[model samples]
Target: MDSSVSSLIRTSYLEQPSAEQAVHPSVYSKRKRLIDIAGALVGLGITAILTVPIAIAMQFDSPGPIFYSQVRCGLRGKPFRIWKFRSMVVDADQKKHLVRNQAQGHIFKNENDPRITRVGRFLRRTSLDELPQFWNVLMGEMSLVGTRPPTPDEVQKYDSHHFERLKVKPGMTGEWQAKGRSNVKDFEDIVRMDIDYQRQWSILYDLYLIFRTIAVVFAGQGAY
Candidate 1:
């Protein structure tokens, strides 16, 4: 985490109201698991069918491992490896500091990020890179719908209020993605949406978001 962001989190923590109510316990429920399991099974089947073609494309586009895994903060800040298709050059992380961030947050985002390979760009835009995360969902590390998972570094930069977003499991797709994902330049907006989802959570809402995500993915709206 950046020193500046660390300082901000500290300052925000100090300023946060102490009387804020705890996140609803119902956000974590057995019904959510059923949804996750069903979604993951279907998603894994799709992943199985697409794996070979995606692998070949990624290999020809750039030589590296086909899959990428990184530690991401899950429910209540638990660390777990989040899987995805490799969508950048092998040295992408090393080169991250070379480019300016287009998104306004601790997280990095650049629509025209130079480190993205040709095949990777298509995968990212289509959200095909995120396919492997269904395995994470199947394994109980993630849910099919919840808040976007943050990197540990990003979580380290979070304010006290921001921790509320992690009250439920991290997700493959969420309210943020169903809303304008790339169009959301401000991280605070993402946090607000997350908190809202946590507060208003229901199986029906999750289903709605899943269907909405399918529409968003098909339209390729607000995607990099």
Candidate 2:
């Protein structure tokens, strides 16, 4: 390619858009507060209808809470509680680090983590535990598709570039989920995916990730 054409392409494709310029920018204008509201409302309705049976099974199988909530960093480092159906013992948070099943680069996972309950395993495998997060999307604490929200502790470990992910709303699913899901082994790999999404944020990419996520979730591949 000629230098002039290459320069144009670089400016068009690789330059980072300033945060102030991107709030509801035209390239990704389809993302809006109301879209989240309408989508999450319908999603919650479906979850509400399904929750009864799932809740009963969860309660019977485990003697503790039916739901779990944790503080996660959202857009621009804002803190919010991300909700999920309980998929582990009530003491999971307290014991997670002490346990030996922690995964690579500060991620915690184990295929046979002893903390999981019968219902919990199913929920985690099928990602049914994540249903309550639509309320987060409805509240604008998250996007239906974007970068996964990181825990406060996880954020603390991030380098300077990783902070760029906070420039947009945290997502329920995104490039990492659709591409590799739990196979994302290191913090640097995650940072690369998040930066790639931010640089190429577009409606088509979001839609692609959404459909890909559905397939991966159904396959339950690499899920723990």
Candidate 3:
């Protein structure tokens, strides 16, 4: 509920399509939900298999909780707690201002962030840190493929057009993740990609992005 995001939402209301037009058809929405549920069920199984080892490594590498959760803006700019594996020091947020962000705009990114632990770096590189988000997807707070959710602080800085990305549920992997995620330094670029996904969304497109995500995760391209 930042002033800037609120203003953006009001402005977007005037310029964007009506709710009926903006929303996907019922059939498409239902199919997407089914896909999300199926994907999350499978992903949770993998998460269960990896949780023990990952937890042990995280504890040994950095003393903190095994899971990390933060408030993120989701569909229609609603706030939700997005979950992930703890890939950084427990005080990462407290010390965030101590380091400089390499990325442009409100989004923070530091390729060589000191807050990241040894095991954390590997988790980030392989995107294993995002495994816990499958629960979010299964819980209907997120989608399997959609725009990456933004932090409340980041959303506070958004312009009118940037709010368009919040039309759909946020995703664990999306067009940004499928493309050069780390290389995208500008927050505008991320917004553009998210908006693009929204405009061009289809079940097949989502599947394609999901497959692309697997390849990107395996290759570890453009990941810090």
Best by lDDT: 3
- Candidate numbers, best lDDT first, in rank order: 3, 1, 2
Would you list the C-alpha lDDT of every candidate in the order shown? Answer: 0.83, 0.75, 0.84
Winning candidate number (TM-score): 3
Q: lDDT tens digits, residues 1-224, model 2?
A: 23453343233322444653243341245555556677799889988997999999998999787789987777656678899999998898788766674466635667678888999999888888889999999887898777878776676565556666666788888888888877777767877887788777777777788788999999888777
Q: Pick out the ten consecutive residues of candidate 1 with the lowest summed lDDT.
A: 14-23
TM-score of each: 0.89, 0.84, 0.90
lDDT of 1 by residue, 72-180 (tens): 7776566778999999999899999998898887678887899999999899889999999999999998999988898877877776778777667888888899998
Better of 2 and 3 by TM-score: 3
Encode model 3's per-residue lDDT on 1-224: one tens digit a residue. 45676555445444555652254342258889999999999999999999999999888889889999997877766777899999999999899999989999868899899999999999999999999999999999999998888877676666667767777888998999999778898988998898788777888999999999899889889998
Report each candidate's C-alpha RMSD, comma-separated, in the order given. Answer: 3.8, 9.6, 3.0
After superposition, which runs of candidate 2 have C-alpha atoms over 4 Å from their true positions? Answer: 1-32
Which regions in candidate 1 have their CA more than 4 angstroms from the true location? 1-27
**Model 1 CA lDDT for position 130:** 96
- In order of TM-score, best first, we have 3, 1, 2
